[model samples]
Target: MRFYGQQRLFELTTSELERYREKTRELDYCAERPEKRLLAEECREMVTELEQRKNRMLASAIRRRQREEIEHALDEAEIDAEEIIRELEGESA
Candidate 1:
């Protein structure tokens, strides 16, 4: 017989989170510099592009982890289901 258990989520390592924070700090620093500020029209466009790319990369990383967890859970469920079916067949015979 198979029993369903709680699903424990796996989170990113401390180093990964720290690296993300560092990138955020760098972006803020770039924005605050007077000479390098994104005030100019051309610079504004470039800043926007950079921000979008950063956001996309972060989102992709989060989505990748979520996808992996879901895949792991599905695999576990398949194995449990197969075991249950086998046990039931044995009980009937």
Candidate 2:
């Protein structure tokens, strides 16, 4: 379940990435100048940084989902243990 805040963040990140890509393309088109070439390198670095950020966000989401699943499983196991203990007491009584 993606919350509204998360969805908005994802959209913003995508927009920023696209803008960086556009800047890189413009620089590349006129990269005969040394300064333009330098700016293009920086633009490329920003694109790489954005890609890494996306990967990190995906990893975080995966970890969060796995943690929730583990907690749910532990809760079910605890309930089952309690039920078994009650049955054992009834038999001994």
Candidate 3:
């Protein structure tokens, strides 16, 4: 997968984007070497950008259920990212 911009994420369906973000997060957490971690960090940043775009889309969504779902997904992604960061920090400590 291309890890450059939100444009790729914008092209994906919400579900696909979420899955991609989650997978990227997992890869970030599993990175074993410094170079791998650097690449993972880049991917994580892309996912973060995608999340921001998703939030903007969520704001303009008209459907209540869709908004709620996106909100929930955002919350989950934030929590997951935080946890992974903490885990990585702990490993380095």
Cα lDDT of candidate 2 equals 0.90
Query: What's the CA RMSD of model 1 in angstroms?
Result: 10.3
What residue pairs clash in candidate 1, if any at all?
none
lDDT of 3 by residue, 1-93 (tens): 224344455557466667767777777777887876877777777777767777775555446567788999999999999999999999999
TM-score for all predictions? 0.51, 0.81, 0.42
Q: Per lDDT, what order, best first? A: 2, 3, 1
Please write out the lDDT profile of model 2 over residues 1-93, one tens digit for every residue.
257787677777788989999999999999999999999999999999998887777787788889999999999999999999999999999
Q: lDDT of each prediction vs. the true structure?
A: 0.58, 0.90, 0.72
Let me know the TM-score candidate 2 reaches against the reference structure.
Answer: 0.81
Poorly placed runs, candidate 2 (over 4 Å) = 1-3
**On TM-score, who's better, 2 or 3?**
2
Error of 2 at 58 (Å): 1.1
Tell me, by lDDT, which candidate is best.
2
> Residue 84 error for model 3, in Å?
64
Colliding residue pairs in candidate 2? none
